[model samples]
Target: MAEPKNEEFLDDIEDAEAQAYAEEMEEIDDEALELDQLRAERDQLRDRFMRALADAENARKRSDRDRREAENYGGSKLSRDMLPVYDNMKRAIETITDEQKEANSALIEGIELTMRELLSVFKKHGIEIIAPEVGDRFDPQHHQAMFEAPVPGTKAGDIIQVAAEGFMLHDRLLRPAQVGVSSTPAS
Candidate 1:
């Protein structure tokens, strides 16, 4: 009877030990699952932050490009309006002949000085004249065809005459040179 009682007590101790070990294992498994969930949440947040940063950088670059363009081309409208004044000055100078200059030396000199000053101002503002000479190849980008004519010794698409000179503000054309293009082949 004593031996059986001792055996029963030992069996009860073993059962208690097994149950405690199983409960400990369940707690460990729950902790590991919670750790994995936290890692996934952290990765998602990091991805969102990276995307937002890229968007901000792109917006900044776009704004800088817009500002530069505005700075470079802001005076285009005013420059365009002043072109007719320059044209009139040039025409006045062209109409004066040697006889006229000799007859009115003082007046001619004053007109010449004023024209020079205007041209200097134009140069300072990055304004350039697009003057295509006769016999030169006609470029549509800088020249506008006012008329086409057949002329001897000129190939088709050659510049026959320039009716009015064009103006350019930097690389942008304020006005295209009005020209007559040759329609006949070279004789």
Candidate 2:
């Protein structure tokens, strides 16, 4: 009877030890799973942070480019509006006869001075005239052909006449020169 009782006690001790070991393994597995979840959360946060940083950088660059363009082209509209005034002034000067200039010398001088000042202002602001001479090669970029005519001693595409001069605002064409182009020489 004492031996049976001792055997039963030892079996009970063995069962208790096995149950404790199983519990420890379950705790370890739970800790490992929690660690994996934390690592995945950290990776997702890092990816979002990188994407947000890139978007902010791109927006900043775009704003800088827009500011530069606005500074350069802000006066385009006003400049375009003032071109007709320049044209009228030039026409007035051209139409004046020598007799008219002599009779109204003082008035003519004042007009000439005003024209010179206006031209000075235009030059300071990067406005320039595109005046092509007769016999020059016709350039489609600066000259607009109003008419084409066959002429003696002139090659095709030669500038035979300039009806109106062109103007440029910086590198851009404010107006194209109105011109007559020569066709093939008459047979």
Candidate 3:
């Protein structure tokens, strides 16, 4: 009977040890779950940081491009305004009477040379004249129609007259060419 009692006590001790081991394992599992949650959060933060850095870089690039464009086109308006002066000087030379020019050949030559030099300065600064020649096809991108006229032999949509010469600075249009375009003949 005593031996039977001892055996039962030993069985009880073995059951208690197994329960303790199971509880320890459960605690370890809980710790592992918490660690996994922390790692997931860290990964999300890292991903967000990288995305923000990329967005900032893109914004910086856009700002740089915009600044360069602004700087390049800054003088366009003033340059356009100055074009009329150049045109007036040219007209003064061209419209002078033949008698006046013949009487003052040296003075006329000096004025002509000055006009050429002024044009050279314009070219140096990337300013260009938009004087389309006669019989040239009218381009709406550069020409502004002031009137429509029918000529004896000229085709429709052709530039018959330039009211005011246009100009461009770099690739930007400073002014559209004021032009008289030919009209379609009356049927």
Candidate 3: clashing pairs of residues: none
Number of clashes in every candidate structure?
Answer: 0, 0, 0
Q: Ten consecutive residues with minimal summed lDDT in candidate 3? A: 69-78
What is the C-alpha lDDT profile of model 2 across 1-187, one tens digit per residue? 9998899999988988988988999999999999999999999999999999999999999999899767655667877788788889889999999999989999999998999998898788777889999999999999999999999999999999999888888888888999999999789
Off by over 4 Å in 1: 1-26, 97-114, 185-187
> Least accurate stretch of 10 residues (summed lDDT) in model 1?
67-76
C-alpha root-mean-square deviation, candidate 2: 3.2
User: Which run of 10 residues does model 2 get worst, by summed lDDT?
Assistant: 68-77
Q: Output the number of the TM-score-best candidate.
A: 3
Residue pairs clashing in model 2 are: none
In candidate 3, what are the lDDT values of residues 1-187, reduced to their tens digit? Answer: 9998899999888888888889999999999999999999999999999999999999999999999777767778778778888889978987989998999999999999999998898888788889987778899989899999998678899989988888888888889889998887565
Score candidate 2 by lDDT: 0.90
